[model samples]
Target: MGIAGRQNGVTGGMILHRTVVLVGMMGCGKSAVGRSLAARLGVQLLDSDAEIERAANATISEIFARDGEPFFRDREAEVIARLLSGPPCILSTGGGAFLAERNRQAIHDKGVAVWLDASVDLLWERVKHKDTRPLLRTDNPRKTLEEIFATRVPVYQLADLRAETLPEYSIEETTDRVIEVLLTRPDVLEKT
Candidate 1:
């Protein structure tokens, strides 16, 4: 579904007090858009993957290869929990984080979840050259992305809000769109 249609469910004048959590596939501009959005909103920004990497003393790729995906997911959940336990802020979660029900519930209970929706073509165009993604290290990166996109799109749809991250737009524009969503649908930002 398109972003405008996705936003129809959020209406009425409700205030939002929780953090804004960005959830989507890799290369959907969560980190960049989130940082800009947080700055514009005058809130702090935290990247869960970066936090996990810092805590593990290694890159996400290294962590995955060394400890395995299960271990990495466990650590990711822990880091996300820790980050969410703190004050309201903008959090950019790992692409696969929201695939887990525990993490999804945590985000739902703790913040306003915004799914940065992007088409498979857009995602591929943005991420095809990035070697930092462990999941993309396959013989065919396009196929890998397509697989992940198919699986994760439905999962991301469960988010409280949805915003399109067009390649033509700047990060500031994406952030502005998110800000507009938050301001228009404050109910999604309510603390639980």
Candidate 2:
């Protein structure tokens, strides 16, 4: 039975009550964990970055290089709003998505924000080899990541829920932790 699916507290099929928006720093496993959570919950997974890429017909890096970060952020906000307004599902937002007050307000209004928290060491290990992150493509990428991480943690903590990630945990383990957190909020995920 799905985690939230229940009738009189007995396991059955779940009905998603609200969108679960995953917010965190890059390499924090938001996408991977969100995908697993959605599958486990029998729901769809909406990735803001992928959605933005599809809408713009360009990669995030391409958009940044061509139109700049402001333009990319504008598109990101639009995609996030569109996704949140759609249905109750798992939404994985880009690392910087929750940094904007407008985006945070929208998420708070329409969904439950779950910050997939991970240490900078773990995040660095995960993103060190990835070229897809535009913000990390600096001469000193590690330093850049550190700076971004420092600046974003406070904002991410504003999320309604927090799912901490560790290098020792597999994707399933992380997803399980997230589920535990979500279940604590009956309005977000019921026992049934």
Candidate 3:
């Protein structure tokens, strides 16, 4: 809590009137930044993936393997809708969540989507070593990532707000950037 920000009530604290749905590529730090942003705002961070896993009683990869991507997506949508219907909180979604039009509409109708933008190279570097990503279990993950990136970025651009995730910035810094962007949408968040 910087004195300047706290005195001005810019970054010191805020009242969230709507759920903030974090949308972007997998490695864009949605979960990490959501944690920090929720903490800064004195609210809960509900991770859609975690919620789905809890209800299904399985890891994401295991769910994908057992029930398939389509089934997982159906469950994801349900979880997202359910979370959005609750009181305002930070919602971190899976990378593919925003790609679906139904999910996008639900988010816009109930919450605000904040895209956490990152370059394809940055995203690849972050996710390449992680086998937990069921989608990246491919013969050429880098190429697959490129395709996914190209397909999804345009959709991500439709978010109500956006925050850049620079490799040089720490999670806290990125979270601050998210706060700055959210501050712009006074209807969604307000200084308190």
Candidate 1's displacement at residue 137, Å, is 2.0
lDDT tens digits, residue span 47-141, model 3: 89899999999999889899999999999999999999987888988888999999999999999999999999999989999998767899999
What lDDT score goes with residue 163 in model 2? 91
Candidate 3's error at 100, in angstroms?
1.1
Query: How far in Å is the alpha carbon of 144 misplaced in model 1?
Result: 1.6
The alpha-carbon lDDT assigned to residue 166 of candidate 2 equals: 95
Tens-digit lDDT track for model 2 on 95-178? 778999999999989899999899999999999999988788899999999999889999999999999999999999999899
lDDT by residue for model 1 (1-192), tens: 333422322223322367789989988998888777665554678899899999889999889889999999999999988888886778888788999999999888887789898899988988887797878999998998999888889989999888888878889888778877776665544212
Q: RMSD in angstroms, all models?
A: 7.5, 3.5, 4.3
Q: Model 2: clashing residue pairs?
A: 4-192, 5-14, 5-192, 6-192
Candidate 1 ranges beyond 4 A from true positions? 1-16, 188-192
- State the lDDT at 13 in candidate 1: 33
